[model samples]
Target: AQSVSQHNHHVILSEAASLELGCNYSYGGTVNLFWYVQYPGQHLQLLLKYFSGDPLVKGIKGFEAEFIKSKFSFNLRKPSVQWSDTAEYFCAVIYSSASKIIFGSGTRLSIRP
Candidate 1:
């Protein structure tokens, strides 16, 4: 079985500040990794994904993440964040043969404008 963990359950940031969120997964087989973000009262959207190829992947809203196979980590990063970045972020993982996914509890980011 696969599992996902997010280091922080809540993150507070100031507008225009840099942001980084840690995500890690545990699985024995090949896996698909994703970071989903939900804005205030909005639905979730894909921040990034890692299925194959390059270890480092980029996502929307100036966000990026690096997939480290050895570390089993995919950390989300943004050079600068906006007040609009305030949202709940989730880390999810799916294995090649798994029918379902494992998601982190979620990280609520509050951006102080």
Candidate 2:
């Protein structure tokens, strides 16, 4: 079985501030890691993913995440933030063999302009 843990429940930042969200997962076998974001009233959107190849993956809106296999962690980072970036972010782990996806308790981010 796979599980995810998000260290922060909520984060507040000013416009142009840097952002980093911590995420950790536990799984024995190979799995897919993903980061998703949901705006105030919008549907969840994929932020970045790591299935294979490079550990560093970049997503929309200048967001990027790095998968650390040894530590079983995938942390998200953004160089600069905007008020429009306020949203909920979730970390997900998908077990390829079982085709099951597990998500971490989301982290809500609020950006002040």
Best by lDDT: 2
RMSD to the hidden true structure, all candidates: 1.0, 1.0
Ten residues in a row with the worst lDDT in model 2? 93-102
Please name the candidate that would achieve the greatest TM-score relative to the true structure: 2
lDDT (10s digit) by residue, model 1, range 3-112: 89898999999998899899988856799999999988788899899899998899888889999999999899999999888899998888887888788889999999
The residue pairs in collision within model 2 are none
TM-score of each: 0.94, 0.95
Candidate 1, number of clashes = 0
**How many clashes (backbone N, Cα, C below 3 Å) per candidate?**
0, 0
lDDT of 2 at 60: 93
Instruction: Report the lDDT tens digits of candidate 2 across residue range 5-93.
Output: 99999999999999999999986688899999999889999988899999999999999999998999999999999999999999999
After superposing all C-alphas onto the true structure, candidate 2 shows an RMSD in angstroms of 1.0
